[model samples]
Target: MLMIKSWIYCCLLTLPPILGLSQNLKQEVEKRIKAEEMPAIALEILATHLSQASKIRYYKETDIGHQSFECKFILDRLWYSVEFDENGAIEDVEIKMDFEQIPQAALDKIRYSLSAYDRYRIRRTQRQYTLAFLSSDDLLTMVIKGADELELRYEIVLSVKKDGSWTTYEMLFDQSGLLIEKKEVVDRQTDNILYQ
Candidate 1:
C-alpha cells in the first residue's frame, strides 16, 4: 500500500508536464441537438443552400478549446458533414470517403507516411472543405456543385502498431497526401464517436 501511494504521488506530479509536452492528442465530445437549439442562421443556411441533403442530423461538438455545431447527412449518395461556429458561420464541410476514392497521389503520400509503422489501419477518412482561401458562401457553393476549385485536404483517423503497441492517430493531409498534422487520439480508445 505504501508503494502504491508513492507511485500515485509520483504520477500526479509528472503527468501534467508529460501531457502538455505531447502536442499530439485529440479529445472531443459531441451530443445531439435539435435544429432549434443551434443558431438560426445555421438552419437557414442549410434550408436555403443545402436543401438537397437528406436525413440531416444536428450535433453540438465540444473540443479541447472550443465548441461547434455540426450537420451530418447524405448528399447525392455521399455522406457529408458541415460544421459551423457558434455564430453559425461556416467552418468546414467533410465528405466521408472510401480508400479507393482518394486520389492516387494523395494515397501514395499517405501510404509512405504510414509505412514507418509495423502495421496500420485507416479508421475514418474524410475530404474536407473550408473557407481558408475563399468566402463561406463560395465554400458552400462548392459543396453544392461538387466543385474542386480550391485546394483539398484529407482528415484520417488511423490505428497503428508500433514497438508492439497499438495507438490511434488523427492525421491531416493536403491534396497531395503530405501530412499536415499527426496527433494521437486520447480520452477514449478512439476519438469521440460523433454518432452511433
Candidate 2:
C-alpha cells in the first residue's frame, strides 16, 4: 500500500507539468497566429460555407490582411472565393464565371480605359485610400483628392476569373492618395490571382 501511494503521488506530481506544457504550446500557437495576423476563425467560417462544395482550395494569406478560400462546385461547374476577416466575418465574396480568364485582348482594353486619363491633376493635399468591395470580383479604388494641384499616373491590374469575378491584385497610390496604377494578374491554370 505504501509503494502504491508513492507511485500515485509521483504520477500526480508529473501531471501538472505535462498539462502546463500543453497549455504553453497552445498559447504559443495563438501568439504566432496573432503576430502573423492570420484569420483562423475566418478560415473555419469559409470551410463551413464550402462544406457542400465538391472541391475546395485555400490560398496563402493575403497582404491586405484577409484570408482567401476558393470553392468549386464540380457538379455545377461553378467556382467562387470568399475572404474573411480575423474575426471570421464574410469580408468579400467572388463568383466565378465562364469568361473569368482574361485574355490579352482584355488587358488592352483595361489599358485603354486607364490611358484615357493622362493628366490627373488633383489637389496637393493629403488623402487616405480606403478599400471598398464593389462586388465579389470588383474592388473599388477610392481616395480623397488633396488641396493643391497634384499630377500623377499609375498602372493597376484587375484579375478577372472564369465566373466573371474581378479583383485588384496590386495598386499604387499617389501623394494625394489616389490610385495611379494597378496591376492584377490571374493564374488561369490555378484560378488564383496575384494582385501586385
Candidate 3:
C-alpha cells in the first residue's frame, strides 16, 4: 500500500507539467496568429466571395510569426487562396485565373462599367497606361492600370472605418490595361454574401 501511494503521488505530480506544456503550445499558436495580424472578419468576407460549388481543398496553420491559416478553394474553374490569422481575420487574398478563361463579353461589361466614372490623366510608359480617379469627397484616390500578363495587381490605400470595414472609392485595372479583370482577382462584398 505504501509503494502504491507513492507511485500515485508521483503520477499526479507529473500531470501538471504535461498539462502545462499543452497549454503553452496552444498559447503559442494563438500568439503567432495574432502577430500575423489575421483578422477574424476576413473569414466571413471570403466566404461571401466564393461560389456555391467552391470547396475548401486545403487548410493548415502556418508557422509564419502569427498563427496563419492558409486555405485554398476551387470555384468556377478558378483557384482562390486566402490567409487568415488565428483570430480569423484575412491577411491576404489571391485569385488565379487565365486570360483565356475569361469570356470577352464579361470583359466588355467591366470596361463599360468604368465609363461612368470621371477619369483623370495617368502617367504612361511605352508598355503601360495608368489613370487615377478621386472619390466624391476627394478623400480616396484610386489608380488603375496594367502591370503584366501573368498577374493582375491592384494597390489600394484608403481609410478604415471604426467598425473595421474599409471605405474604398478607388478602382484598379489589370495588367492588360483593362478594368474588367479586376473583379476576377478581388472578391467583392456582393461576391462574399452570394458565395456564402
Candidate 4:
C-alpha cells in the first residue's frame, strides 16, 4: 500500500502543467492600490500622460512569481494598461481592444491557427508594446502616432479542448501572428474559511 501511494504521488508530480497538476500555473491577481502605495519613479513616468488620461486607476498585479504595478486608464478613446516592475521600471504597456483592431494580415493568421483546434473562442484581446529604455513621453508619443518602431504583440486568451476536457490558454503572437509563447491558465479560488 505504501509503495502504491508513493508511485501515484510521483506520477502526479511529473504530469504536464496543462493537465492541471502544476501549482505554478499562470494566474493573475490584481488589487487596487492608492497613490501612496505606488513607487515614486512609476509616478514620475506616469505624470506625462496624466493630462489626457481619464478614469485612471492603479493596481498591484501578481502573476505566478512576479509582481508589478499597473496604471489603467482611457486615452484617446482607447483603454491602456501601463505596467511597472517593483523598482518602478517600465515593463510593458497593453491596450485593450476588440479583435477588429488587429491588422488584417495578423487576423487572417490568427484565424488560420485557430482552425487547428476543434473549436475555440477568444475571450480577451490586448495589444502589447515593449520597447527598452523608452521614456514615458516617448512611449506616449509612439502610442499616439501608431508608430511601428515598438515591438507589438497580441495576447489572446481562448478556451480549447484536449483529451475530453476544456482548458484556457493565453497565447502570445508577434505582429505577424507568429507564436511567441503559450501558457495554460489555472483557476485560483479564494479561500472560504467558512467552508472548512
Evaluate model 1: give its lDDT.
0.85
Cα lDDT tens digits for candidate 2, 99-195: 2232345434544544544332221221222224333222211111122232332223344233444342444444333455554433334435544
TM-score of 2: 0.31
In model 1, the worst 10-residue window by lDDT is 187-196
Q: Per-residue lDDT tens digits of candidate 4, residues 1-196?
A: 9999999998777776648666654568899999779889889888877788899999999987799999899998988988889988777888988977899999999888877787787888999987666875577568767887787899888898766677889999999988889988765454674465
Query: Which candidate would rank higher by lDDT, 2 or 3?
Result: 3
- Kindly list the per-residue Cα lDDT of model 3 for residues 1-196, writing each as its tens digit: 9999999999897988877643333221222233123344554555454445356653646443655665566656645555555666445545554433434664455346544544422211111112223221111011111123223333222222334343333345454435433211122349666776
User: Which candidate wins on lDDT?
Assistant: 1
Q: For each candidate in the order shown, give its overall lDDT on alpha carbons.
A: 0.85, 0.39, 0.42, 0.84
Best candidate according to TM-score: 1
For all predicted structures, in order, the TM-scores are 0.79, 0.31, 0.29, 0.76
- Least well predicted 10-residue stretch by lDDT in candidate 4: 187-196
Candidate 3: global Cα-lDDT?
Answer: 0.42
- The residue ranges of model 1 lying beyond 4 angstroms of the native Cα positions read 1-26, 187-196
**Regions of model 4 farther than 4 Å from truth:** 1-26, 162-164, 187-196
- lDDT by residue for model 1 over 1-196, one digit each (tens)? 9999999999998898777765454567799999899888888777865577788899999988899999998878989899999999889988899876898877988899889999998889998888887776668767768886777789999899999999988899988889999888863523356654
Q: For candidate 3, which ten residues in a row score worst on lDDT?
A: 136-145
Arranged by TM-score with the best first, the candidates are 1, 4, 2, 3
